[model samples]
Target: MPIRLTILIVAGSALAGCSWAPPVQESRTGQIITAPANPSGVQRGPHGETSPVLLTARKMIGVDYAYGGHSPETGFDCSGLVYYAHKVNGIQVPRTAAAQFRFADPVPRDALRPGDLMFFRTSGRKISHVGIYLGPGRFVHAPGTGKHVTVADHRSTYWRARFAGAGRVKTNYPLRTSAVRNPR
Candidate 1:
């Protein structure tokens, strides 16, 4: 074969290979990772308002768990953390864990999403503990005195055995609305 013809064939083959590359598919769940087309939409971080609440909660890890404390610079208890998180996110929530659990819609364990609150009976008296679900069976919370806010596996023996229930705060935006005509 002529040298010029060989070079042309090689160049054509490279371009053909590039055109045949497979399209990427994103996995919304599980460990086989894939990148989404709109990276800003699903990427986890503080960049977007929806997931910033979780980022703020995560930033408080290692802060002391002070009873009745609500300020991030000071410390936080279970309810205080929940209250502060929602408050900063522009959502109004009850100050105590029990009350917070009451006003939201109940979510099944299997259906829990990030930002959903999980309640537990640490004292065997009431919903004394709570955590923010971080998806894939993990949650963040201020455990108790001598412990700091942290993330833990939901399937852990400690949390799994004491699981009370889960709740989702209703956003101000209604699911549906009726149309109305304007008066002239």
Candidate 2:
């Protein structure tokens, strides 16, 4: 085998076991590594507003606020909406704002992307509320009692004062719809 071919084979084998590595594909000429496509068809990088999690949250706009609720039929709370959206998109997250904040990978406010979590200290706590960033300083969230899920600008006086931080969620494998167990 040629020197180039030998080097390619060795490099490919070295990367095969890295779970965090992007996919490596064998092209006609050589191996090429590329980022995996989001299963929900949302484009990665800058266009994150189209992510399935965001889409799911957007669908809940106008849903009545129900403390501790996590589904459309029962309405949703701030964290419940986040939980439901991430759940449907195969991303498992904590069910409370504080827990979610503690578990997420922190992102700076200046660097927040469209599906990043926007945390707030609304209840005079460390992180009492959360919303999904929708880019351009706007975010979608289920406000408190008597309010509905709505998009609000983070730069607004109320939210700006309460803005605690931001975070990014890593995706897990897409969930299987079947609940039946396979004996095999």
Candidate 3:
């Protein structure tokens, strides 16, 4: 067999038993292995108003999970929640999880900041579910029909098994400001 092919087979063998090792983590030597920056190459944030995006999403906590829903009156699906949140905040994103995954900048699980998106392959090989990271390993998502918008433990068994990588949106989110007004 060729040397390259032989090496590939040996490497595969070494990892055949263990399943997942997390998308990223701090090495014991105190080094980060996968702290990639935003693929868009832009660093300024809150350009799309992250706080409004999250606030809008929080207001939707009890909204039903409708397959094609996009509004409070209609409820929301997974991607729909992301869409509505961004859209209402003056930012726009694709309407489906698969499309959203393809368009956003890929992120390591450990480098996730609040307002970053977490994806999942709940049903098939393709990305299916989407949620917004709310820091501290929590995310908000519209689970499914008959389910309401809810907070989920990102590290739980069900989610970890289905855990896909994270994505960073290059939006002007949370609306940062340099001015503070004193209360009269």
RMSD of each: 17.8, 17.9, 18.5
**For model 1, how does the per-residue alpha-carbon lDDT over 108-164 read when each residue is reduced to its tens digit?**
998776778898988875778888887677788998888878778889898889888
TM-score (C-alpha, index-matched) for candidate 2? 0.68
Over 4 Å off, model 1: 1-50, 173-184
Candidate 1 root-mean-square deviation in Å: 17.8
Model 2 CA RMSD to the hidden true structure, in angstroms: 17.9
Task: Compute the lDDT of residue 14 as modeled in candidate 3.
Answer: 52
1-184, model 3: which lDDT tens digit per residue? 4554355445544543253243478899999887543321112244533455665675567667899898766779999999899888777788888777876778889888777889999998878999988766688899997888888889999999998778876765434222222211
**Superior candidate under lDDT, 2 versus 3:** 2
Superposed model 2: Cα runs more than 4 Å off: 1-49, 173-184
Per-prediction TM-score to the true structure, in the order listed: 0.67, 0.68, 0.66
lDDT of 2 by residue, 99-155 (tens): 888767789998877788999998675789999987676798999899988788899
Worst window of 10 by summed lDDT in candidate 1: 175-184
Q: What is the C-alpha lDDT of each candidate?
A: 0.70, 0.75, 0.73
True-vs-predicted CA distance for residue 117, candidate 1, Å: 0.5
Name model 3 segments beyond 4 Å from true.
1-50, 172-184
